[model samples]
Target: MSLQPDQAIEVFYSYAHEDEKVRDKLEKHLTLLRREGVITEWHDRKIGAGKEWQNEIDTHLNSSQIILLLVSANFIASDYCWDVEVKRAMERHETKEARVIPIILDFVDWESAPFGRLQALPEGGRAVKKWGNRDAAFLSVAQGIRIVAKELAVSS
Candidate 1:
């Protein structure tokens, strides 16, 4: 699974619509990696008009090397997030086809969730919203994702 220097690792953003703003902030923090060709991210918002959204989502979810689960109360409450996206993301992670990292955006009782066993971002699984300085929180998340991106580039 060696990535060519020019091939940025594909990142699939699986999150509830309520978390878009926070997701965008994280994306902004990831600007350096995107600019340096380390990763490319895809989410539902990128789906073109007239496209089948579900099919498009499934396509990226199945193909991407990294699946980012943006977690929060709203995210967990969404049936689609809990049932389809999380279910498939965990399946891929278990098979070694992709890396699934949970990004805790808001505090939630998620220790029993399917992705609970995997390491979460933002340093110590602190909710991004609970941070005193939001940029600092995003920075922690971006750095962690950067590490995962580099790992995916190495021997596998």
Candidate 2:
């Protein structure tokens, strides 16, 4: 489905709860993108009271132009993250309604990832080592976001 002319570009950040640090970094980056008029992001961290989290997540997953999966060992380990976000995103992808961009925050066996066959960002040598030089990794992630935003713009 095409986004309305005035509808904001919705993005869902999927990651394991254990990887809070990486999630925080992604949130900061997405915030910057929002400030720059790139896209708006949704995540459990931004959920407020009085809202059904599951329904909210499904709504965003259905409406979002892209779902950025923060792939890591911890992310794949979380059943909720996989079943709720990753699987939902995959369904959307099957319908060609939304795109899933897997961002590698930590080394995960790509061949063994829950969502097999999805291409991940910064693969192989470009993969980021834990707590090492994060700048390059963040830059790579930002680039991937830009690419998705550009695609969305063109498609819309």
Candidate 3:
């Protein structure tokens, strides 16, 4: 299943609420990508209200063409993040309906990540050492998002 140009490439961002700083930076990158016409819409908890969090998440997940997993310690610790987002992304992978891009923001057991076999952005393990600088890390992540956006655009 391919996306339509006018459909707005929906990206479902999965991350732990505890990593608010990382998530905020990612949202900013997504907003920048939108302004550049790289993507039409981006969805994340940062824009949703507490009253309908679950519903809002489901809406984006179902409509998304890709899933960006912000792998972090707290993300792996959250059951909802693991069970719902990870599981759904796995299903999407199985059907080849959506692409799952893991962006390692913090130390996570890559060997045990939901889909560690899939190639990840910013690399993993020792490569994370370079991400110690916040600005550099965000820039690397933004580059990864651009790659995904290009792939989606071409595939569509």
Candidate 4:
């Protein structure tokens, strides 16, 4: 997992619009890693106005070293999330081209989903929405991500 001084991992967030608030909180938790230059992350919300959104998403998704799938009922229901983002993410994951991490954001029937077998964040696969303290859940997820980001380091 060691990397050169110039190397850093790029992270991509694949989430549903319904979960934007949760995603924002999680992104905050990940700030330390970004500050330390361990990783740089992107999501649809980062797309600028007037830009071709799909092209921006595809470029980021294709290049990121770590892909976080923010799983929830809404995420599972989104056609774009399932049919496009998840499809390509999994393809990259299967080929060892990128690492896919399923982040449980809410309770849903997802054990049979494409990312079912991958170990999920906030240990025990407990959904963030179900946690007694939501911040604690995000902290757990961030810590897990830190570990993986370190292990998955790549050339910038």
Better model by lDDT: candidate 1 vs candidate 2: 1
Per-model lDDT = 0.91, 0.74, 0.73, 0.89
TM-score of 4: 0.93
Candidate 3, after superposition: displacement of residue 128 in Å?
A: 5.2
**Model 2, span 1-156: residue lDDT tens:** 233435557788887888878778767766666776668778777778898988887777788988888777888888898777887898888888888878777766755655567776654424566536687677677777777786777777
| The 10-residue segment with the lowest total lDDT in model 2 | 122-131
Across 64-100, the per-residue lDDT of candidate 4 in tens digits comes to 9899999999999999999999999999999988999
lDDT of residue 36 for candidate 4: 82
Candidate 1 residue 138 C-alpha distance from true site, Å = 0.5
Q: TM-scores of the models, in the given order?
A: 0.95, 0.85, 0.82, 0.93
Clashes (N, CA, C under 3 Å) per candidate? 0, 0, 0, 0
The lDDT of model 2 is: 0.74
For TM-score, candidate 2 versus 4, the one ahead is 4
Worst 10 residues of 4 by lDDT: 1-10
lDDT of 4: 0.89
Question: Per-residue lDDT for 85-155 in model 3, tens only?
Answer: 89998898889888888877776676566678887776433233356676666667677777777887787
Error (Å) of candidate 3 at residue 13 is 1.1
